[model samples]
Every structure is written in C-alpha cells, then in structure tokens.
Target: MVLGWRRRKNNNHKGVKQNVEVIVPNHFMCPISLDLMKDPVTLSTGITYDRQNVEKWFDEGNCTCPVTYQIVRNLDMTPNHSLRILTQDWCVENKQHGVERIPTPRIPVSRFDVAELLIQVKASARGLDQYGCLELVHKMKRLGNEMERNKRCIVENGAPGALASAFDAFANDSIERNVNVLEEILSALNWMFPLKLEAHKYLGSKASLTCMVWFLKQQGLSGKEKSIVTLKELLSFGDEKHVEALSEIEGVCELLVEFINKRISPTITKASMRVVWYLVSSSSPCSDKMKLAFVELDLVSSLLDILIESEKSLCEKALAIFESLCSIEQGREKGYSNYLTVPLLVKKILRVSALTTEYCISSIWKMCKLGEKDDEKRVIVEAFHVGAFQKILLVLQVGCGDKIKEKATELLKLMNPYRAHLECIDSDYKNLKRSF
Candidate 1:
C-alpha cells in the first residue's frame, strides 16, 4: 500500500482524499526480500529488485531470476534510476510517517573513465619520473575495489601490461633504489593478480621476472611469500613459453627449495610446492630442466625434512613434490642420496590421510619399481637399510585404499624373494616410524 493511501489527517495530500491506513506500495518491495527496494535495479528478466539483493543472488552463483526462476542468460543488472528516484521521492514526502529517506547512491566508476586512467598510467610509467606512475597505480588499485565492473574494465584496458612494465621500471631504475616502493607496486599488483587472464605475459618480462626470482632468494619472508604467491598465480595460467622462461631464471629452483627448507609457514611451504608442481607438471621443455634443477639444488633433503617437521596438509604437499623429484634417473639418485626419504615415505604412508597415500605409495613404488634387476636389488637393500621393507609389511597388515594396498603388495612380492637371500630384522620395522 503506497503512502498515497494514507488517512486524511488533513487535506495536505495533493490527490489522495481518503481516510485509510498509511501503507507502502507493493511495487516498491523487493520480490526476493519482501522489503522496500533501495537502489533498485532491473535484472534481465525485467524484474526490479533491490540492487544489493539481486547482486547478492548473482554472487552466490544463482543464475536465474529470483521471481521467474528462469535462467538469466544475461546476468547484467541495470540500475533502475527512474524507480530509485520515485522511491526516494516517496520517502521524502512521507516524512510525517516513520519512513526514512533513502540516501543518494554513489556512482560507480565508468569503463571509459577506467580506460582513461589506464592511458594516463601508461604515459606516466613511460616518463622518467615514476612518482606520477605510482600515484596513478594507487588510484587504479583503489578504483579496482570500487566495483567489479571497474576490475573488468582495468584488465580489458591492459592494466596488467601497463602495471607489469611499471614494475620492471621500478626495479631497474637507479634514481629510485627503493625496495619499499617496489613492494608497494607489487602489493598493488596483487589486486589484479588473481583475476587477470594471460597473466604470464606480465610475469615473463625479462628484468621483472629475474627481479622477482632474486626477491624470492632474499631474507624477508613477507616479500618472498608475496613473490611466491604471485608466481603461482602466473604459473597457473602459464603456457610452454612461460615454463621455458621460468626454467631459464637463475636460482629460482634453488630459492624455492630454500623456502621449503626454512619451513617458516605452512602457507610458504604450500606456495613453494605449488610452484615446483606447476613447473614439472606442465612439462614441455621445462620438465627435464625442472627435474634436473630439483636434483642439482638438493631439494630432496629439504623436502624430506619437511615431511617429518610439518603438519598433515603441508606434509602432503611436500610428499607430492618429492614424488616429482624422484620420477627421473637424476632425481632418483638425489633421493637415493637422502637416506631419510624412503624411511619417511614408509613412516608416512597410510598415516597421514587417504590423499597422502597416493604420494607416499608413488614415491616408494618409484624408488623400488626398477628397470634393471641390479637397480631393483640395490633399492630393495637400501629400503631395508632405512627399515622400508618392514614398513611395507606393516602397510600390508594395516591395509589402506585398494590402490595403495596393491602397490604395497607388489613391492612386498618383489622383496619376498630377496628376503631369503638378504637379511632383515622385525624390530627395525617396529621402531622405523619413530626414526623421523
């Protein structure tokens, strides 16, 4: 019921001249909320609901009209400025009643304005004095949060390219040898890092990627964490060329291994593992290079240490990376050098979670399942050295997932024939879990 239907306390109402209850108009109410619409917007279904309500629906992954329950082919919500004007005006005229006036909504930044800002930023970044560029970038970051529309506008307008070039300029500029300033630039870039498409192009710039890799090697954990996360984001979308570029960056694998060795934070360890996984998993030219890098850097030792020291989730990630490191001959030698790896896998198998069993089984299986009968005999002997043979017996007894059980059973059969030829003790297996 509109206030237009209010009782005639006096003849002040211009058109309404009836004695009735003061009520709000039904059209003013949001269909979803059953409350008066504030900042009304029209959906593609031609239904007008409160802007906040409709947007909340969309953000929650609902794709249909709240009223019609029909698929919203175009999810765009156009602001019902005219209806909003009427709603606000009605509230103002009904001040004698308890209705509060709806305040005017702030306008979101337009796409054209965002593009114009990007143009200004590109021009300022190219200039010798980057003060203007930094200032403009700060503005862009602020504008980016103002609306999702602005975020899309920023990416579409080539904000990633502009900001990436600016990042390189900041790093190499002699006039501004300020790490804090570079951090600010990187931090601002974080806003778009998670959302931007073709992001590897930004990260692949020569001086810039090198600077980030070197930054990862430095002491500050905060800086390294941010760099790792940004690197992971880029690698998530990285293609063959980016992988090669990453492989070419000196000290990248070494620093990643260093971060894992430090074991300061679960987040840091996971980030490092993700980088290693992406490089190895996205194999092309980088697979062999990355596997060799893992061996050359002696990551096997650090990753092994993490298996013992970290929590369940972190241990799972470490195990995963270790699995990759041992997949190749060089990687296998690196693991063979680390006496703790086989023992650690034996200790952790079926102990962590079903998810980790795959990693542990694969690592242990890769260590033992050999092409040469001589290598098989060698690894089986090494397995006994670290009590791996006994642990395999325990996995058979404990009995985990079918795949894990099968893998353990296979290794057991291989070692069974050698059991009579070689020597082993039951007590070594019992205490092996406590070795780490």
Candidate 2:
C-alpha cells in the first residue's frame, strides 16, 4: 500500500488530509497475479487480463479462459486501449503514492506487414539498386530481432523463401558485383532457419546450390562460415532430391573437405564435416559420386591429420567421416596406405567416447577385412605392433554394446596368430637399440 495525502473538503473550504493510505481498485489488478495490469488486453470471451498473464496462460497449453473456464474460440488478445488509458490516469493521480505509470507496449509485427515487406523484397530483387536492396534486408533483420513474437511472425510469413529467392536471382546474374548484398541476404536467411518446406526448395534450386558453393569457395570471406553452417542445415532438412542435386554438383564435397582441412574455426570445421558426411550419406545415388570426389581430393589424409591434432569433439566428427570413407574400397586402400591409420584407430579405442570408439574399431575392421590377404596380414601385424591387441582386450573386459563387443572380439581373433611374433619383435627391438 502506498502512502499519500487525501483531500477532504470542509463545509466552506478544502483542506489537506495527511498520511492517508490508498487502495488500488480491484478491476486494475490481474485476475491471476492480482497486480495492476500493465498492458491490458481483452480476450474473445470479453474478459480483460494483463497481456503477460494471458500469454503465459496460452503458453501453458490451457485452452479455456482462466476466469470463465470456457474454451477460447479465438486466441487473439485485442489490446484494450481504453482500460490502459484509465490505468495510466490512475497512476498519475496516485503519483505521490509511489505508483508507477506503465508505458505503452510496442505492438508485434503482423503477418500482413511481413507480407508487404516480402513484396518489397521481391521488387528490390528485380531492379532496385544494391544499396537499396541491402537497406531492405537490414530493415527486415531489425524487425526480426526486435522481439521473439516478431521473429516468429516474420518466419511464419515466408522470410526464408523470399530471401533465398532474392539470393538465387543475384547469384544467377553476377555475384562479383553483388557480393555484399548476397552476403547480407544469406545472413538474413540464416536467422530464418530451420527453414520452412518452401524455403528448403528455394535453397535446393540449382542457382542457390551454386551460390552456396561459391560462398564456400571464398575462404576467409565475411559470411563464408554462415554459408557453411546454412548449407549444412539445408542438407539436414532431408530433402532427397535436393541432396541428390547437391551431390551431383562438381567440387561441392571437395570444397567442404578443403574447408574442413583449413580448420579456420572449430565451428566452421565441424559444420563443413557434417555437410560432407550428410551429402554422402543422404539417399543420393550421387552419393557414390561424392564419395569418389572426396577420395580423389585425398579426404582420408586430411581426416587423419585432423584426428591426430583434434580434441574429443573434432575427433568424433573426423572418425565418423573416416568410417564413412572406409565403407568404399578406394577409401579403405587410402586409409591403410597411411602408416598412422591402424595405430591412430587403435589409440582412439575406449578413449575418446563410446561413439568414437565404435567408429574407430569399426573402421579398423572394415579396412583390414576387405583387403588382399597380404595386405590383411600386414595390417594385423601393424595392429599388434601398435598395442591394438591390448586395447581391444580392455574393450572386451570393460564390456560394451553388442556391436562393439563383436568387433573387438573379431579383431582379437584376426590378430591372435601374430601376438607372439609382435612380442618377440618388441623384445628384439629393446635389446638391439645400442645407439640412439
């Protein structure tokens, strides 16, 4: 309760009344919180509640009005301007009573407004100057960033599709001159993901696909990282036809590999690797084309380099990519040809994480099992040489999933014959090293 002076008129004159407590009118308080309504809004049920309280009610999944308990037919909360005015007036009258006046809340952007902005975006795409176009995008981005509801409304109204289409158009014309505008468009679209179905189709277009490849090619470009991450998100949307089209694009996977090899930033590297893995693993008959592309680019060598230097998270991603590569014959040959292959795979077992251990052990099995007899024996000998036998034994002893356990047991069986030879070799080396 606030303290204030109350005015009482005598028979002939008015006089000040001191130290009177003021009571807030009941209607001014929220039904839920019993606090004064800061932003009053009336529901379809003809009941007025504080905007915050009503929105919280809806967010909690309540279908009925809090007071009436009747199903709300329409969820729109119309702002009660008159009630707000009165509430503000009351606050002014009680200023000395420590009452604070509520300021008017900013209205959320409506779908119609978003649609109008998108229309302007389309028009800008046609013939507007690059500066003008960029200004519009910046405006749209500002709107999206203003409030969560505004962002949701903007996304729900096809911002992604509009931005993607504009980017595609610019890409088809001349990207060299429109680089800044295109980058801004990409940045705008990045905020709109996970994109709606229509936006996915837009990004999936040939022009958009080519644009993404161009972005990825420009190392150290301002928006290149965003492009990489956006491309990965697009691929993850699981459109088979789009995945196929992307895989068929020349140098797409290769560029991704090159980006990963750069290790410019951990985020960019991880996102690029995810894109590579998804494209090859996506249901594209062009998947083989991508895998071949990756192999030709010497992706295995890059992955091994990453595995040796990376921490646990990057190790997991690199190993996953390695496992996918090893599924094919050329990849297996490439992996085995690297002397670090068996030893590195052995070292990672039961070390990084369960998933990494799985990938490592599985990759080793695939590489050794599918090669020629002589190559197989060589890999086995290398495995024993690297203490792969001892690690696999620990893997079995510590216990694991059936799949990994089977892999570990199989690896032990394959290397069993050479275990003693490996031991003797170790002893001999220990004794023969006279001068180091």
Candidate 3:
C-alpha cells in the first residue's frame, strides 16, 4: 500500500538519480485478496492465493475454492512455484523502484511432523528421553494453537494422554518439588481443555483430577491460576463418577473458596466458582459436601464481596455460586451474618442484569425464609431497615422476568401486613401495591 519514489544525489555529481515507483500488477496479486502473493499456493480448483489467506478460508470449515467457487473434491493445495518465481524476479528487476522481494515463507507444518512430535512427547513421558521435554511441549502448544488443523492433528494423535502422563510423572519425581516445568506443560493443555475424548481418557486412567488438586495446593500464583483453569475444564468434561470423586477430594472445595476469598484474577475466581457450582449441582451429601465446603471456607462473604465489586458478567457468576450455597442452612447462616448480604441483594434487585437480579432475589428468599418460616421478624426487620423492602416493591413494578417478579411478589405477600414499613420510591410500584 505504501508506494512512493525519492531522489538521491548522484555520486559523480550528475544532477540526481530517479528512483522510479512501480505498480504491482493485478494478475500478480492473489485472487481472493487482490494483494501480491507471498508463498502463492494453487488450490485443487486451479486458483492461486497467498498461502495464509487460503488456509484461513479452509480453516473456517470451507471445502470449496474461494476464487472459482468450485468444490475442492480433494482438499489439496500445491505450492505455485512458477508464480512465486515470476513475482520474485519482478521484485528483483524493480529494485530501483523501492520494490523489495518478499522473503520465502516457511513451509506449513504437515501432519506427519505433528505425529512425530507426539512420538517424542510420548517417549519423554515414558522416560525414554527427557532432555527437551519442556521445549517440545512449547513447540506443540504453539503449533496446535496456530490453527484448527494443527489442533485437530495434535489432539487426534494422542497428545492429550501424553500431556496427562507427563504431568503425573513430573509431579511424582520433583526433587525440589518445583512446578516451573509443570507450568509449561499445563499451559499447552489448558488452551484446548475439555476435549471430550481426552477428558474420559485421562479422568479415568491417570487420576488426573487428583493430580490437578495436588497442583492447586502446591503451585505458586501463576501455577495456581493455570491449575484452576485446568481443573474447571476437567470437571466440565468429566462424567458422573468423576464428579462424585471430585466432590470428595479433601481440600478441593476449600482451595476454590480460597481462590474466591483471595480475590484472584477474575478469570481464576470465576473458574473456581464454576467448579464449586458443578460440585453442588448434584443432590445431597455430594451437594451437601460442596455447600459446607463453601460455608466452612466462609465463602458467602467472598461471594458477596465479589458480587457488588465485579463487572456485570462476573457479578452474575458470583451470584450463581451464592444461589447454590444459599440453599443450605450453613449457607443461609453465612448469608445472614454478612452485613453486605441482605443489603447487597437489595441493591442488585432490578439494578443489575435480569440474571443477576434473579440470583439476588433467590438468595434473599432463601435467607429471609428463615424469617418467614420461624416467624422470626429479625431478618424481615433487618431487610426493611436495609431498603430490601423498597427494592422488592420495585421488582413488582419492573419487567424483571416472570419467576423473579413472582418470587418478589410472593415474598411481599408473605410479609403482607408489615410491608417492611419503608417508602416505595418507584411510582409504578406504588400503583402496583394495591394489587399486592
């Protein structure tokens, strides 16, 4: 796109030398982009394009050629050497015109090369050779993340199992108990985690989840974030038995709570919150174990802290964890104790997104139900004092979704006569109050 010429003084005192500007020819350009091709590759459809552009088209899951619109009966692209040679020759000829020959691009990786890498990675895992295990993993991670084809090639060639075994072996053999090498291996696996087939394979064979739990406990800050990411992916792809087992891991829940309480990166906090949510997804004992784990770790305070401070997206995640924990008595106790709990829900009502508002009210219902059920007016009294009643009245007026509105309305009915004794700020709710 940059095309210009300049004048330079002649060595022999000739007035000046003209650097002529040249225009790149249309035919010399890629058909798909109309830009001059570096590493021109001819498709099975007989159209030549820059290798990167053509590969991108196919990587987006296309089988037809872009220029001809022909079905690539076979997905093959041949290097258009003649076109490249002519283009390079033109650049050389036009050197005085500010034309620089494009350097030859590196050849794209072949599946054969990927398969060879897996062999070496597997051998390293088996202790056949270990000199460059970290380097090999780095190479595989870069190539795999480069494109869908490379990722598919690596995962399809048993790289996942190799990675899991390498991690387990490293964890077992650490003399200094160092996790630096482990961090590099995990960064690769973390990128395309939750691979369903690999999940079943490693979760069943290597006791990978337990290994991850250990890593979470042992790793430094960087490693801890990566570990949480890996564990969440593992739990997401794991089966019923895997969840049953993970729910029972002694410190897993506490570790997640710690991540939340420490206010680690939002990525880590949300990921940890998700794993806790999954553990509590199942019924009693399994669910109960995770619930107590949250309360025992003082998770309610952490959840409330994040719920108000974070971005809307993350606030929703924190609220989701609160929703699950609030179902248990211990969860309710923690929610009731936190000064921010009732008032936070009060503030979020009709104030945040529809989903957050739903979680907010649900937590309130669970906590305030203690008041509703035990005829204990203390919570109802506190909610009224905290402006929770005003927000609930506002929920009745706004279009906060059916279930949330209904819950808010019913909560009002339950506290019918008292009406929390607070002024309804929203005019719409004042009119709606007659119906309530």
Candidate 4:
C-alpha cells in the first residue's frame, strides 16, 4: 500500500533519510475499519469489507449494510480475490515500508463438523479413556479459539448440555484420576458465554453440588473461577432444595467467604457474590442459618472492602448481599462491630445508582433505632459525624421515591435532636426544600 517515498534531511544535517509515505488504495481498505483489508469479502449489497469487521457488525444485531444503508438480503459474503491479490502484491512491493502481506484467512468450520465433534465428545464422555476424553475437549477448545464462527457453531449444536453431562459423568467416576479432564472441560466451557444447559442434570442433584464444592476447594486449581461462574449460572435455574443442599454441604459457606476475601477479578467477585446472594436471599429456612454462617466467616468486613472501591454493578451486588445480611440480628451486630460499616454506607448514599443508594439507606436504617437511649445516641452521633444528615437531605432535594423519602425523613428526625450537639448548621435545616 505504501508505494510512494520521500527524502528529508536531519535537523542537524546528520544524514539524509528516505521517508516512505503510506497510502492505501480506496478499494483496498475496509469501510468499517479503514485499514487495508486482510480478507476482503463482498457483501450482497455489493460493498467490500474486511471479513472480520463485517462479521462482527452482523453479530451485533445489524441487518443492513453499513455503507449501503440497505437491508442485507444475504448474510453470506463472497471473497474479493482480485482486491486481495492486489493488496498482497502491494505489500510485497512495499516491503521496505513495513507492510506485511496478510495471510489467507481460513474458511469457517461447518455446523456438520461441530455436530460430529459433539457426538464424539458425548460418546467419549460415556466410556472413553480419560486421556482420549481430554484430547477431544482440547480439540473443541482449539476450534473455539480459532474463530468466532466455530464457537457459535459449537454452541448452537448443543455444546453446553453435552459438556455439562460429560462433566457430571466424569464427576461420577474417580475424581482424582479424572481431575485433569474436568479442568479442561471447565476451561472450554468458560469461553462459551451465556450457556444454556439442562439444569436438573448439571446442578439439581446433591452429587453435582458436592462435585462443585470439591472444585471450589481446589485452591491451586486452574478452573476454580470458572467453576464458580458455572455454579452461579446453574443457580439461576435451581430451586429451594438446591439452596438447602448448598447450605448442608460442609464448608461451602466458608469457601465462598474465603473466595470473596481473596478479591479476585471483578467478574469472579460478582459471580461469587451473586451465588451467595441467591442462597441467602432465598425463602428457605436455611437462608437465615446461611446468613449467620457468612457473618461468622467475616463476610461483613469483606463486603465493606468491596464497597470502598468497586464499580457500579459490582457495588450494587455487594450492597444487595450487605442488605440481606443486615436483616438479621447477628448480621447487624457484625456490621456494627466493623468500624467502616456506617461511614461507607453514608459515603455511597447518593453517589451510586438509585438502587445502590436505596440499599445503603436501607442498611443504615436497619442498624439504627429512633429512641433517645444511650445506644441510640451513639448511633445518631456516628451518623451525624459522617454527614449522613446532609446526604439524606440531598437525597430528598434530588427527589426520590416515597419509600426513600420516608426513610430520609425518619433519618432526619433521628439526627435533628442531636444537631445541636453535633456540627450541623441551622441553615442546613432551615433552607431545606421539602419535595415530599
């Protein structure tokens, strides 16, 4: 593409150097990426684009040609062989200008090929040797990694359910001998997002839950994070018995708490938090006991640490769990014991999203009371010191739901009596606009 060159002198006349000016022919560039096309393919709209760029555009729910602005009659693309040859020739001619010839792209794998592979995988899961099964899964992963089309093909052919059953099959065998294959399957499954699996076979049983807990215990295992993510997905379709079974599992709660305390990547953090929230927020009686168990494992302090620097979504999840915990006496006691609890809630009052702000206010409300007793005075002083009054007043000014307004009003009443003893100004209350 850089067939032109120029010459210029150094600033101090140290040397004369050739400066190559790179120019790509208009037809050689993809309209979407504005770069020389590596794999030029023509759409049905008679527009040429880089294969990867256009494929990505289609994957994002686009039904019209980006350049033509017309409905795409055909999703298939025809290779622009002439333009590709010209581009490759230009690259070779401009070798000194740092242009590299693009390699020929591979054709996408067919659904029939993926279907055949899934059949082999399912067969291997039933009776193949451990090494054989592992190799097949690695092949699937390689195919998945090679191209997006192959991954979609594999998933559309039911890779998720097959893989889940395969994992369950291996779990039923000698786990110590089949751990390697299990980890490989988990690694492959991790790349396949939005998994659609038969929940009853994957996680509805006690044995499956036990197998998952074993994976969670493998501290040095490569698939621990993936296992948690998979577990969270399964819980979406799980039921009350499943929740109870998780609580009955030995050390499951502790492992979950330890996982949270590790502060791994935010994705894994949110996944693990969601799993806990699902369990603790359930209507089952074990939910209360699980809340107490988490509190005992120092879950409150871990959540506080998450709240201090987490993003909006993860912060909302952490706050949801925090709110669930505060619904109990032991949880509130543990929260009050942590020095950072109230101040962090006050800091996040109006700063995060409305849902997050509601969680914060609800949590703070649960931890405080209205009486003028010594204990109440202590909590009121803490809230006043942290500027809770001003934040709640701001919440009212900014306009909130009736429930939030009611809580804010009650919070204001709690702190108003102690304002004289605290740092609040008279104008802070006098200049207030009551939107409620």
Candidate 5:
C-alpha cells in the first residue's frame, strides 16, 4: 500500500511540473528599454523591474517574471525554469553585443543645494547618531563643490532660471534650519561669481532678496559687521556688469554705509567706503533705485560723517566721491548740488587737510575750480582759513609752478581782504628761492 501511495505522489508532482512548463513563457523582456533582462531588479514603485537584479527583486518580495509581469511565488520557484533559460540566453547575447548597461548618473547639485542639505542635517544632528550626522555633513561639503561648478556654468551662460532654481532649492532645503550654512553658501556664491548677472537677478527678485535678508538676520548678520561684509562682496568685482544690479537694490549703499559706521573696524570701514566711491565714480547712470540708497540710508551725511572719523585711505575714498559728485555734470542736472551745500562741503574739505596735507591741498584746488560764480567764490573765500592759505602757499613755494602759484595767489587774495597776508607769502617765496 505504501509503495502504491509513493507512486501516486510522484505522478502528481510530474503532472504539476508539466503544467508549470506549459504555462510559463520561455523569454521575458522589459517594455521600456526593450532589452532582455540583465539583472532583473524590482523598483520601490513595484511596477519596474530589471532582469539583472532578479535575486534582489525576490528578496524584496517582488519575484515577478519581467516578461509576463506575473508574480512568481518564492515557494514555487521551480515553476520558472523556462524563464531562467531565457534570461541566461539574453545575458549571453547582451555580452556579445557589448551592450553596456550603465546606471543613469545623478544630476550634480549646486553648492547652494548642498548648503541647504547641510542645514537639514545640522538641525537633525541631535537626533541622528553622531557618526551619521558627520557623514551627512561630509557629503554636503562634496555637494557644495558640485554646486559651485554648476553656478560657474550658469554664470557663463547667463541663465537666470538656473540660478533661481539653485537658490530656490537652497531656500527650500536649508535656509530655514541652519542659517549659518546659508551664510556659507552666500559667501561662496559671492566669492565664485562676484559679478554674475544671475546673482543680481536673484538679488533683485523680491522672493530671493526677502529670503536672503531673512537668512542674514537669522545668521546674526543683520549688524554692521555682517552687512558691510555682504555689501563688500556684492561690490567687490567692480565690474560694469554689476553696476546696474547694484543700483537696483534699494538702500544697499546706505545700508552699507550704516553698516560701516556700526562695525567701526578700519579694514571693514575702508572696504565699505571704497565700494561707495566706486559706485559714484563709475560712469553708469545712477538710477532712482540707487538714489533711494542715499535717501533711505542718509548716505551723503553718513559719507560726510565717515570723512570726519575714518583713516587716511578711507578719507581719500570719501573725498574721491565728493570730487566725482562735484565734477559730474549730472550733479547739477540731478539737483545734487541743491541737496548738499558746497560751503559746508568746503569746510569738510578744509578739515581733510589736517588729516593729510597732500589730499587737503588737492581737494582745495578742486573746490576752487568748482567755485565758478561770485557767490560760490564768496563762499570759498569765507570758508578758507589761514591754515588752508599756508598749505596753499607752501605748495606754491615748493615750486608747484606758475599756473598753480597764480591760482593760489588769486585764491589767497580772495581770502585776505587786507594786504597783510601778502607780506607773509612774499617772504615764503623769497625764502624758497633762497633755499633753491
């Protein structure tokens, strides 16, 4: 009876195997790539599978035949013998054809994007294992380099959308949590593409600027040290391409001046003053946007104030701005003269001589030229003091030449109503001649 039972079971198994072979197809193919399965791997979506990753698919409960899209049960693996033969044949054909199947490369993320990612990792660091957080931070640094490279490409191409997208990703990904990371990104961006038009576009866009300001505040950059650093970065390139964008940002110049005052460091103050000087000196027309920087930030007064307190180099820069303001025809057309007093400015000019004899002398000479009218002449006369006269005479005595001496004598005569000053100047001239 036992022998009879064993024979019946064997017959049943044979019948099941025959049925499985009849049902299963010999070959399977992927619809998308239209290639025989190399390593049939299942995707998280459950709909896609690669023949090359068949074992992985089965491990993940996705033991489905790629050709028929039928789920093959793990326990009934024996049923798919025909499919296996077909996969082996396909692999051999693929090797013969030299059809190399490479995985798609990931799109390189920007430094801005990596910064955003680092911010997220930093926020969650407390919860993550220390080693994991460290690893993420390291990954973020690598991503930052990729971002810098992409930004360089965008800058060269003049692609605002690419820059905007990069900034947007950064804003959405990282600016909210680790504000310092955003700062690092901004610093990097500022350094990499200091004059990129796309950066200006991003800065001008209300959304981007607002987000940046928010990030700045969060990073404790709202103060003068940070603000000045930011502005210096903006104006560092000193390129004509950046001028329009620099003018576009409302109150940037004034904010920069205010920052300089607050920060009060010689280096920072010097750099900030230089940027303002560059803007005024550049031939580009100052826009209402740029004028707004003066109006809102009281930049003129701030500049005058800086002239009062800053170091020699900073003072020279401020004086250059003054000189440009006085000389540019637009100053009168733009009614800048109406807003600022030449006489008060002249007094400030005289004060600069005490700071640097050469600078003050040069400034006075320029101021005298600006004094074209009688009223302007009278103002110059009243403002000029004996100290200024002595400096002018000293310059003349040192043999500044006939033209300078003539100008100085004329200026001196205007200042000295009585002829008593002439005796001192005549003495200095004789003394200089005697020495020579």
Candidate 6:
C-alpha cells in the first residue's frame, strides 16, 4: 500500500507539470493602459510587468507567447506597427489645442509689455535651456499667429494700435534695445513655428531688414562682427530683395573683404562669402564703392586663400564669386589681370587640389576654361612650365577619371593651336597623335 501511494503521488506531479506546459495565446495586458504589451517592463519580483518600468522593447523579428514563452514562428512581429501607433498617439496628445489657447491680454498691451516679453525670451535663450524658453516661444508664436489672422482687422479698422505701435517702437528704439528684441523674436519664431507660414510672415519682411541693419550700424558692427551680424540676421530678413538694401551699405563690401582677409571663423567667413556671391550673382550695377572695397581688401588673393583652406561648399561659393566678378564687363578689361593672372591662379588651383575632390575638379575646369579664353596664350604656356600640348598630354596622363577631366581635355584641344611655338610639340606631335 505504501509503494502504490508513492507511485500515485509521482503520477500526480507529472500531471501538474503537463498542465503548466499548456500555453495561452493572449493571457496578459499591460495594467497601466489595458493594451497589448507595449513597453513590457519587468519587475524585481520577476513575475510582473509595468508600463513605467519599461524603457523600450524589440521583437527580434518573432513574437514570444506571454504565457508559455514559446517563439511564434513565421509571424511578422516587426514592431513597426506598434511604434507607429505609439508615436501617433503621442503627437495627438502634444499638439491638440482649444479655442482659448491664445495667451495675449484681451486689452491692447503697451510697448513696455512687448519689451518685457522680449527680455524674457532673450534670457531664456541665453541660458540655453530649451524647456525654459518653450513657454515664451509658444506665447510669441500664438501672438504672431493671432496678429496675422487679424491683419486685416488691425490694418483696416485700426482698433488695436498697441501691437503695431509696439513693433514700431521696437524698430526705432536704441540699437542695443532694438537688436536684443529682434534677436529674441527671431529665435522664438525659429523654434516655435519652424516651417509655418505664419512664421515666415512674421520674420521675413522688408521692415525687419531695415530695422536690423539700422541696429547693426548703430552698434558699430564691422568686419568680422558685421559678417556675424549678417550671417545671423539674413534668413530672418527675407529673400533676395532684402539683400539689395544691405548690400548698398557703404562699408558692407569692405566688411566682407575684411572678413575674407582676416581668416575669421570658417562659419562667419562662409556666410560673408555667400553674401558676396548673392550680390554679384544678381547682376546689380557694380558700385564704385564696392569696387574700391574689393581693390583695397585685395579680395582676389583672399578668396584664393579661402579656396585653399575651406571645404567644398565654401570653395564652391568662392568659385561662384570669381565667376561673377569675371562676368562684369569691367572685370573683363585688360587691367584686371593685375588681380587675376595665369601664374597666381594656377598656384591657387594647385593648392585647392588638396582640399576636396569637387573643389579640385572645379578649379581645374576653371583654369582650363580661362586658358581657352585668355588673349595671352603665352602666359598659360609659361605658367604650366610646359608647352601647351605637353601640358594637355600630362593632364591626360595624370587624369583622375572625373568629369572635369573631360572638360579639361576639350579646352586643351582648343588651346592646342597655340602650341606651334613649342619645340617639344614639333618633335612629339606624331607620338602624341598616336596616343590620342
């Protein structure tokens, strides 16, 4: 009887283990949200899951049964759908708004109120605390949006002169005060309404540029400081039309030239280079002041130096500036060779070869094109230290298989006629022709 009882107990234990092996397909839900396991947070007890405890999860390309811990084969448990659902819910909760969301006072607020708001925005930005600035940016964004929607109301009825008057006051205030406010507004708008049409309406306007330049000049910003000011302020000042007024400033060109000469921080120097490029690209009448500035600053050499040191983007801008300069009728005159000549340009091109692949190719293409156009073919021949044909043959030999080589080859064929003066070409023509 004792042996029979022990055998029965063992059978019962085996039966209980079999029952435990039975798997449930959907046995549990997250307690917090009552949804399928999201962030399946584990606990210290090793038996419970919680939402707050979980950071994130990955399926590893298969689903594991919550109860039996068996991997579900041939199941597409990629988790992409789960992530989308979570993100969609998160966005909706964060962006949902009500009618009374606007924060401006019902009554018209005074200029001082705007000034105070601007000060707070500046303080928040200076601290570099994103959360601290968020509230102020939201408020400004709401105000700017409201003003735009009611633009017809303000401009036509003139009911609330307060906001318009405040803007005018800010625009005409002392340089330091006005610029500080403008900077704050710009920063706030950039953050709060990035890519919003209302943001463009608020920030991109002629009035803004007028005010900004006035403030910049009043602060006596020039050279690197002026470059920085332009760099930070241009996008907020709208598009190409706004550039006209800024470009017309007496010292603006000189400031750009100084920026190029002093080797300002690459960021500021790049910005200054862009400003010059736009000015030249527009085909605006070249002012005597601009020319004199370029001459005084020795802009050609400075630009070449930048081409040698800067990355491809800056080098591209520098090349564009060079092209624009050459496009002007006066730029094509004989005397201009004093600034841009075959020897100096060749040296600069060689220096650029070490900078970037795009820059090196561009420099080579420009040099070859210049050779084809130059009236002084002797200068090109002398500068390359070989006969024109030999130079072309050497370029073909050392070519890197970039598109620029093709362009260089085309220009070489054009300049080959000038090779009649070279002794090497006469002796090597048959061999060169065979190779070609």
Listed per model in order, the count of residue pairs whose N, CA or C atoms clash below 3 Å is 2, 0, 0, 0, 13, 0
Q: Tens digit of lDDT per residue, candidate 6, span 1-436?
A: 0110011122465554221121112323443334434334343323233232221222233244343455434322222334334433543443422111112123333344456665665565455444444565456555555544222222223212222223334444443444544444444333232233333333334454455445434543332344244334444434554455566555667666766666546765776777676665553455334544464455665655554446667766776666445433344332244433433344444334533333333444454455345643444454444333444455557664656577556656655665565444222211121110
Q: Which pairs of residues collide in candidate 2?
A: none
TM-score per candidate, chains pooled: 0.73, 0.80, 0.81, 0.76, 0.43, 0.47
Candidates in order have lDDT scores of 0.73, 0.81, 0.71, 0.79, 0.47, 0.44
Residue-level lDDT of model 2, residues 11-112, one tens digit each, is 445465445466788777788778888888899999999988888888889999999999998988899889889988998988766677878777778889
**Which window of ten consecutive residues has the lowest lDDT sum in model 2?**
427-436
* Native-referenced Cα lDDT, model 6: 0.44
Q: Which of the two, 2 or 5, has more lDDT?
A: 2
Candidate number achieving the greatest lDDT relative to the actual structure: 2
Model 3 has an lDDT value of 0.71
lDDT of 4 by residue, 237-270 (tens): 6577778887898988888887777766666677
Please list the residue runs of candidate 2 whose C-alpha ends up more than 4 Å from where it truly belongs after superposition: 1-29, 32-38, 86-101, 126-133, 218-220, 247-254, 384-406, 416-436
Q: Ranking under lDDT, best-scoring first?
A: 2, 4, 1, 3, 5, 6
TM-score between candidate 5 and the true structure: 0.43
Worst 10 residues of 6 by lDDT: 1-10
Number of residue pairs clashing in candidate 3, backbone atoms closer than 3 angstroms, sequence gap of 3 or more or interchain: 0
Residue-wise lDDT of candidate 1 within 1-436, one digit each (tens)? 3433344555676764656465788888898887878778888879999877887888899989988999999866788999889888888887776568988775656667877886887676567356777678778878777767677667776777767766776666642364655665677677676645534565666666777786777638778777777778777775676677877987788777877776677667788888888888676766877888887887777777767656887888878877877778887777776666666776676678866777887787787774356666777776665556677677667667787778778877777776666766423233333233
lDDT of 1: 0.73
Q: Give the TM-score of candidate 3.
A: 0.81
Name the runs in model 4 displaced over 4 angstroms.
1-37, 40-49, 60-74, 77-99, 197-205, 219-221, 236-242, 262-270, 301-318, 337-340, 351-356, 369-378, 420-436
Which is superior by TM-score, 3 or 4? 3
Better of 3 and 4 by lDDT: 4
Q: Ten residues in a row with the worst lDDT in model 5?
A: 1-10
